[model samples]
Target: MHSLRPLIALLSATAVAAPLRADAQTFEPLSTCVSSLRQELPAKVKPETFETFTRDAQDLRPVVDTATKTQPEFQLPIWDYIARRTDEQRVAQGRDIVKNEQAALASIQQRHGVDGATTVAVFGVETDYGRVRGAYPVIDATLSRACLNLQSAERKDHFFTALWLVQEGVVRVDEFKGSWAGAFGMTQFMPGTFAKYMSAADDKGRVDIIHSVPDALATTARYLRGLGWIEGVPWAVEVRVPPSVAQRWNATESEHGCLTQQSPVGKCRRVAEFAVDGVTRVDGQPLVRPNSLLGQQLEPSLNAALLMPAGAQGPAWLVTPNYQAIWRYNRADAYALAIGLLSDALRGSAPQRTPWPTDDAGLSRAEFRDLQAMLLRLGHCDVVVDGASGPKTSAAIRDEERKLGWVETGRGGQKVFIALKKSSAPEVACAAAVPASAPELAASAAASAASR
Candidate 1:
């Protein structure tokens, strides 16, 4: 089964995008899922809800399956991912949301200790501030995801819980619509998260994250707090890694003990630890100071993970625990960074200072699909032609690199595509089989033979 983190990211990106239409062969009935739910969730869900849910549930199995295979995190370059999510238009819209929703956002900040800008940023990224909430019926999407063999047991549990919410009258099945992966509401909460952290801002005895902006923002703030967002700490700060510093902490290393073992976002150490090793801010200033958020500064002892999204030569970041909280919302570094950067933009901070290292940028979705097709033709990969770069595609890239005696970074880029094309060129193949000097040598051999 694919990882749930990428699945969540995929769902978030495609929630507003059109869903794939499935033919009869691709579609599967929800009878198995209904049976399993009855067996597993009898105590938590009532029988009538199960009957109603099954009656209403449409098989979106094909859509969920395709979506899981083509997640944007695995397909897009980090720079592209961040750029699309935190574009100038998104930043402008986010600022407007911050202005218009000030009172409601301030109330959430006071109650949950999560900043309003950050909450608004989450709202913008999750569903474009409720403008592009998903179109799929949540009951069908959840049931579809729950029944799939590729889905994890934990995911199945969560889908069942969503049905239970419908059964218990927490949310109506008719009104429940969301992404193909079952995340709903303005801020895109999974059913399990909604069950735990759904909140109501006003005295009305309801917590509706689906339609109410204030309720959604408050719920989002509550969710972030539950994920361990510190009140006044910034999620991440731009930093500079000195050229003189040793290369042991480079992200490419497979063995770094605790640094490699962290979950979701992965890797963390105290800022002082990197300071001891010569890392500093872009202005060459020491990073021993406290983390600042809005106007408040946090103590310097907080642990932060160093990230180089584009490798050693590119931009660097010191991501705090609050960054991890953002990551918990969608477990991609690119997604978290987009949220942080967008929030900063909404608050009038400058854009990214450093550029990505490579001149070849990266492949687009179409380019990646072409790369996958080329890999398939070369017999290096055997996966579906989805744009996502899964383990099989990465290994295939490494295999091709090995054949060309190039460095085995396993990253798909324009260079890789060019190399594949050049290697497959007829002229290049002919030259490889017959050296450039072969014609001259043939003439010389003929002259020698005639003389003899």
Candidate 2:
């Protein structure tokens, strides 16, 4: 637990460590950053190669800046995070993939210790099962990240590695496009990670995660194995928190356990310790002494942390090493939890036992689309029915929230959905139409999105 202090301190510093930014350098004159990198470029990445590829790279300052600050992982409530990603609609899609792609996934699992369900969960979450692999060019994205944080060697490494990929013909220059952070392809592998885990899944002998599903899934399985994923071992299990235990630890959560990263989540306490302290499975079954195979293999030396994401009042889990491995894939609790729950959903396993501690539960994509449709029908906001909650949607939600005499949360929560549905179809069907508003008001089109 104590060993993570230095790293936590470093992360804290790096979060605000862009001292190179001056009042004048507004992240423009890309050459200022690109020029400074001549000496920092990896030995394999030549200057001519850098100049040839990045000369016309578009500046993604606006997108990258917003993305870094408003990443869902850092900003979203845990329930919203899990609910939005692991809804029944997405789960059904994943199960179909598991059924159809069983042979390919089975081959990859035979090679790597990762499972089809978990790998497909990553595929589903990262790019909506390869449907939306981002729009930014890899060079532009990585360069933008590097320019944003000049002190980050890792960011610079990513940029140079992106160049190297283009130079080495790992991917076509025109085809190297992905997320704002330069993670590309079906499973969203950054340039560096792509290099680390790039391998052909089948006997085709060519690697193309972008165009091929097997390559993408196999690459993901390899990456998970590299990160210490254990097949059949549960990543987390829900547990009923004893009132006494909750009372003792709830107040000081941040200072004690995974909430603060003071203690690593994977090594918080032995299962026996938790059982001694009155922790039990959701069904009241006692955890085995030190060794456990309750659902899957739980090693004797393994430790488990009680993760009450929304404090003692909400759902809790004893997250394990498999969860830690997923965390490495994307270092955020929201993201990891989404992957975990989505994987469970893929296998048709039990859903989350406890609900989030809120009257207005988070909306799924389908539910969000329903909310968007309501917004359009009632002339609340001109939001696109794409189901994504963007700035324009947030503005609309805030406006409607004010009209409803509710505190403006800008969330398309259950309350908002119900209220909007009621207003969209006010009872008194077949009754005389109350004097309609202006024709334009009645025909308002909501084409934007709101917060979750």
Q: Best candidate, TM-score-wise?
A: 2
Q: Deviation in angstroms for 375 in model 1?
A: 27
lDDT per residue as tens, model 1, 102-195? 8888888889999888998888777667755566677677667778753466666667788788877788767787776777777877777788
- The CA lDDT of each predicted structure is 0.65, 0.67
Q: How many clashes (backbone atoms < 3 Å, residues ≥3 apart in a chain or on different chains) does model 1 have?
A: 0
Top-lDDT candidate index: 2
TM-score, each model?
0.71, 0.83
Error of 2 at 375 (Å): 0.7
In candidate 1, stretches whose alpha carbon ends up further than 4 angstroms from where it belongs are: 1-3, 7-29, 149-153, 243-246, 250-267, 290-298, 360-452
Name the lDDT value of residue 264 in candidate 1. 24
- In candidate 2, stretches whose alpha carbon ends up further than 4 angstroms from where it belongs are 1-25, 247-267, 289-294, 424-452
Which residue pairs does candidate 1 place in steric collision? none
